[model samples]
Target: MSTAIDIAALDPASRDAGAVAHYGDPVREQRLLEEGVGLVDRSHRTVIAVPGDDRLSWLHSLTTQHLEKLRPGQGTELLVLSPHGHVEHHAMVTDDGTTTWLDTEPGNGDLLVYLERMRFMMRVEPVDVTADWAVLSLVGPGTDDALKSLGVDEELDEPDTLDVPGAKFAQGTQPPRPSTIYRVASLGDKSATVAKFGAGWVRRVGNGADLLVPRAEKDRIDIPRAGLWAYEAVRVAARRPRYGFETDHRTLPAEAGFTAPAVHLEKGCYRGQETVARVHHLGRPPRKLVLLHLDGIATDELPAPGTPITLNERAVGFVGTAVRHHELGQVALALVKNNVKDDAQLRIGESTAQIDS
Candidate 1:
């Protein structure tokens, strides 16, 4: 991590979930991300390769999203659920004709194991490919323009030439909403730069495009380095729920607000489809996801995850994630009772919070 970030002149390293935190001036970084292009190191993400004749179909049957119409260059999310409809694993999936790539959070060995065990009688094979590939993200309003300046367009296509041998790239998300996904055999080589591969693959996400590249080539990429701090700020303002933090082993798609992005209500039978449907049609989830607007000046430290949230002096929910947004200061994502009124005031570890939903 140091080797890649060192070249970008980022300092005061902090760690978030075992991934390097950022460079410096998170506020400035986020400002740039909202107005111009900024780079964020995403080496901590894990990648999986599903290769076989039935790869697409098999995965479609197992995940929350429909995969039959997922064309090359198109990217969307997938959620692996327990039989009871709890979100167990989440992945961002993309297919490039021969192989379908699943990019997920760190420590995906368990997810891989679970997936491999379900491959009975199918030709699909899931392999952990994080060791071979790396990831980086580009954010900001100007990100898409910057990639176009380098030659890669919004169209997903393999460049005839590349800086690294056997390198191919498609569009996807590493920052939840990303611009591209690059696949390369090796990263030890020094000459493998993002610019050498038609700059990068570009896709449109919210206001910017995210670029994915090999970990070793992160320093080689020419984008300005932004850190996790900036990423968090933008994500919170966007009201996006993270996997392990906001959605977890006990989280249902409805509770995490993933009913649209990650769940297909009309998709065919899946492990937790019954519960998902039942919850949508018959009953409400025990809890519902909400965004919180802390009613005070921003503090040096934000509310910690799992901090108890109280309503009328009684615990009603807990904090999941929080960020001091560049625009909306001291924002957080929380889970509260489905019965909690939107206008109700709450408390998070003594800080008064109100539903921002």
Candidate 2:
């Protein structure tokens, strides 16, 4: 298979090692990502294909989402938890009738291995397809227009299957959900295979869409590209908790804001259902994910991820992703003790961080 586009080769001067950090102006790129359309190279993430007729049922029995009735082209998030209910894996999942596609953060090979091991007598086969496919995200309010520019639009043939009913477990706050896959006709003869198989388009936050493009056809599509910095700034502003950053070995799904979209409280037994039920009914998660506004801090002065958060000189939690948002200024997502007041003043280094209202 052809290798994915060398993102650094697109603009070496703006590259940050393997991934592009920005073109020449990240703030401008961030603005474009918010107000206009910004293309993001997400090829660094991993993709796994679980094929076989038993794929959906097997996955539904194992994970934390209701996937047995996941219609083709529809997308959702799911979690794999430890027996004790700590988060072990998280992925953005979509199906294409024959196969279930899971896209997750880099270095999550464990998710693949775990799935493979759990197959048992099931007919499911998990295969890594990252090398054969690439992920490009179109972020901003003009995302639909940008897809139209690429000759891709809504898949009208597929049923509108966005609503998957379940208990509202995250304090009644609805999380951002993935949209149905769209067919891309711009890739010529390869478009049909892309649509029916692995690669296609799925919607994301900021009215954006994630294009799962074949590695061979990556260069065929053209748009103004933004870097990881621009993409992350928007994500941080959205209060979306990522796997490795906001989560650790002991991170529970409820603690990091994954409970609503990724968990089905009424679903049958899965790996960690017991703990999730216990926490929801009898108690609360020890930590909660919160957005912090780093008041008066410059872009260069932002603290790194995993920086300890202190409240009243006591260690409360740790910062996750921090970025200089276009309108929100310096902001971050932090996992703080659940007892920390929403209006509490926290400290990260010498900078003062307050939970955004």
Candidate 3:
């Protein structure tokens, strides 16, 4: 909804080593991925407090992850999809019945509202803990060292998910007792490290590692920080689909390639249960998401988002994203019709790409 973004609004006092640059400026996003090992003032993350006994049941019914399997000091990634199975909000949930923190995009306020409207008889209470806290995320090579630098380190072989008043870590190796969440996934060379917490403590906690925040407020100053480009680069390589871009109001979980984690096929029923079950078990989905490699350069430029991709001049699908690669050439993610052969020749804008089998 925000058409124009003031880049510096992300992290004004940004200090990152080996940061990426675009248009002569440091791509502040490095704080989360490339340099996930550095300090960040993630003061904008939204935190929701769900307290009460039935909290687990209340959330299990709404999210995609299996809550019964999760223990305290642990967190899991989830997607709260619409009844029709379109992604409403991609979320990460952490709780063991006492309290749960929901971290999601700022645009998805409806999630909080929806939970409130439905909390009539449930003993659980959903409260917005945002004003009370701020969070920072780091996702790269030196995360462990950074945490150790902060004196938040533990020697557990299995990265431990810690419980902070407003924080959680989701993935890493042998972290500490203070680490709220931990996860293991395929990043570029090493997996990513995503940490979440309150906005107010950005400086107070990071200072343990001798890291300091030069900014006083999250909304008052503009930080030329990270955005979707850098975020998606690591996301795509991890085969993760972002909400609005890869999954949205019109797209379903299966087609977005998140069925395994987003849907419990054997579970009794859900919003779009019938349709999802039908396509999943009996019928073939109309379209399939596939990666593409444009065969040659375009005369002018590659097609923009939603431009029809053609093979033999017949419409097959559309381009979702195009990333120019130094090693692999121009690669893209596309939602091509199921009929398109794996070896089908493709036309994107004025160039040709292949459907690598």
Candidate 4:
């Protein structure tokens, strides 16, 4: 039997700075990710802790999601939108009774600044805990088995009810709601917290969980490791939109397919509620996010992000993230004009892409 590899001992070439890009074989990593639980190091992501008697109410007034009644151990996502309804920042939020923990993509200093400025007379205090805390994800059908191996046997509560009003633009089937947070008494002698979120494309790739543990204890957890390459492949295949990858300064919640889970339409007045309500009630967004299957591209020859997607030499949209999937050949997520036909054959450089049905 092959022994479990320690991710901390990986060669420098296999990692991009601190994040593991791959483990010498991206295809094999992707296969392992699809077939069983693959441990992904997400320590580079940012973690913010908001502690106060007024944390929930203060957050409810500033963000797009309804959070005034957020119960402890309940997890959900929220978006910070510009006054014009443009997505500014996004975060995965959960409360642990005393403190509300929010994990988001790195480079979210602006989000912290905004939160500070919004605390007029509120009793909330938001602090950056990224340096002390680290995030790890267990992704695949075998997540429970892997957790069992680590001596974690906590039972998760059912997800909170997500019923809210004014979700008309949240078309198609909504993805699963975020999982309840569970406290793990020990993960190899280290205490940690686990929750299920969209870590591995929760819609298509279910049975995923995230571990929030102290940075010092991350290297001690023994498990087979996968890299960000495998995580991105599964994310792209699931048609899930990420913050930096699928969103830009001009992105609306509905445009990037975030209206369902990230936006609580019937909530009381918030920063960008007017625009979100107008767009939802009036007409379709200017652009729509879609998954595209790139034809005939080698693993090493995939197009870089921001590559222009065209139709008949006319630029229509741009690519976000591209990856080589284990089942699907080459696939990418793109934001195209809403008027673009569903059957339209688009081009990214010389490669032709068909919108995945």
Candidate 5:
């Protein structure tokens, strides 16, 4: 059978955070994701496993989420904050009965070092499993069927799947429920894994699953996959913010819509809790996350990141990400001043934009 998207000339150089830019027509691949299903290779993303007894409570004391109560087979995301409450790292976590699995973005060496340094006396041991594991993404409507075809079943224990809680897998805005993420076998024979595409950890995103496998085996896993460019378009369209783009060293958890998924409002005493509470009750973040609909009247392309958003030719904010939506022609996400009126019409270059409800 033919692969869904052919990427014979896929430039190994044009990568975003080390993942391919596109297989072929990013537009068609994106359309396939929304209407049916598509695959994405996420091996560039990293995975770390924390083992031992003190793992839960120790990690809970450091990050922005309440992970002390994270049960086996359940998954959630958290952010590590600097002492000043800036978001330093983002981790998607899942706990098996024995170990806590953490999934993070590419170029996470600093995150790993920080995590290891914080482990002075705790029984928890942070292991960088990136060398031994790889991650793949099964995106869109038919992900479950694709997994089944590749031997992912409840009865099998080799490949584990963690459907991210609150990730919208179906075509609606309804809240998502946690599902059993199968834990498959370890990485060994490269040829065998490439042929089967099994034996890895899977995490659900807004519309699909992110599969993790061994890094060395990545080249052998010849599968049709979408790239970060396509994924970012849909993600921005969904009003979801990413780590490197929407957040940074100066970002407070609340500033990037991290309040729900990455922060617990009532959770006690993590590194950034005081700032989070202070902002939640007394002050507003200097800026707020907003989705902007770029005007198609004069231009077909969306403005690039860092493009100034202006009102009456006065700068109000800068664009974070912009993409051509499958339905909504041109869209972008911006962190505008909180005082910017909700109905304000802003301009990006010569094109106008609006903050939508």
Candidate 6:
């Protein structure tokens, strides 16, 4: 119910060309993302609880990922699509069997509520547990080493189960000491390691990091420089889809670049299962999610979020997210027509990069 991490103290960075936001602190989003890695206090994301006898089976019938195999201390990402298979929400869940916690944007809360309402007919009980927990994300180059030093062993190559800090769920590994470990295979050069805790300890855990006198003085983990905006740019570069951004109720998985391990086409009948399988096997996607590089696109700059993408003098797609890159120049993720998707030359008033197939 109460936000454990203070957003006011955390900086707010704009998406403007080279902006940055750290731990919530305001900074150049571009610098934060490219030059230095950062920590993001993603306390705002909501968590919903699924409990009861049919919890796994109940959710198995709703979400797009395979739920039967995920154990406690483990988390997996998923796309909750509308019947037509367009993404309605992108979800990451950590389950302990007894309670499967869904972590997603607040915007997706309505969908969770809707699913829960429908669950009234089943044995699983859905409860809003957003107020019950807090989460912090670490990203960028040194992420793996940082986590490995923090009692989490990265020795395991897969998402395995672990019991840590009182939660048992699937994770990437189990060190001599226990903790939940999830893999973030998004960004090209970066990865994410999420450490979660109940609302009561979120603050303590966050604050505790500052006091840790790791003999790791040898491993220069710049925990301080790593913040939210930097992490945002990383997501943009990785072309990792964000809810309410690249995806929406009308955006299909194929069109939004949903190629991650999240969606299991072989998984039997979920709400949008019919469309998911059909599209991958036989149907052609209407649009293509692309990464764009702009060169003086706008007299001022490239448009943000909803700016229309123009190729060959016609509107092809919309700019999902745009940010200035330190080295790569202007970069963006756009949704263009499937036909010209990869062939189209991106032209934002002259700035351009050919889409690579």
Please report how far candidate 5 places residue 125 from its true position, in Å.
2.5
Candidate 6's displacement at residue 304, Å, is: 1.8
Give the number of the best model, judged by lDDT. Answer: 2
Off by over 4 Å in 1: 1-15, 154-203, 296-299
Local error of candidate 5 at residue 207 (angstroms) = 2.3
Clashing pairs in 4: none
Q: Which segments of model 6 are wrong by more than 4 Å?
A: 1-20, 23-37, 153-222, 341-343, 348-357
Q: Give the range of the ten consecutive residues with the poorest summed lDDT in model 6.
A: 198-207
Measured on C-alpha atoms, candidate 5 has an lDDT of 0.68
> Per-residue lDDT of 249-327 in model 6, one digit per residue for the tens?
5787777866343565556787777777666655567887878776647555556676766777887777777755555
Residue-wise C-alpha lDDT for candidate 1, range 1-357, written one tens digit per residue = 222233223332322454545564678778988888887777677888888989878887898777776666666678899999999998876666667777788767778998889999998889987876656676777765666554554343321111211112222211222122322221122233333642223334555554455545556766777777788788877877888778646888888877666776666799999988778765578899888988552456777777788988998888888877877878888888899999997877656888975
lDDT of 2 by residue, 188-278 (tens): 3246445443345554433577777787776566678887888889888888899978887899988998876688766779999999877
TM-score of each model, paired residue for residue: 0.81, 0.83, 0.65, 0.83, 0.79, 0.71
Task: Name the candidate, 3 or 4, with the larger TM-score value.
Answer: 4
**Model 5 spans > 4 angstroms off:** 1-17, 155-198, 216-224, 296-302
Looking at model 1, residue 13 earns an lDDT score of: 31
Candidate 3 per-residue lDDT, tens place, 263-338, comes to: 5454445566666666665446777788777757565454445768898898878777655533345666777888
| lDDT head-to-head 1 vs 6, winner | 1
lDDT of 4 by residue, 1-357 (tens): 133343345534322236777767778888888888888888888889999999998988898877777766566788998999999999887776678888888657788999999999999999999998887888887887776665556544333435433535455332233322232223323233233221111111144777777787676667788888888899898888988778777889989988766787667788889999888886688999999988745345777667898999999988888888888988999999998998998888877899987
What tens digits encode model 5's per-residue C-alpha lDDT throughout 98-149?
7888888776878879888889889988988887876677777777666555
Clashing residue pair totals per candidate (backbone < 3 A)? 2, 0, 33, 0, 20, 33
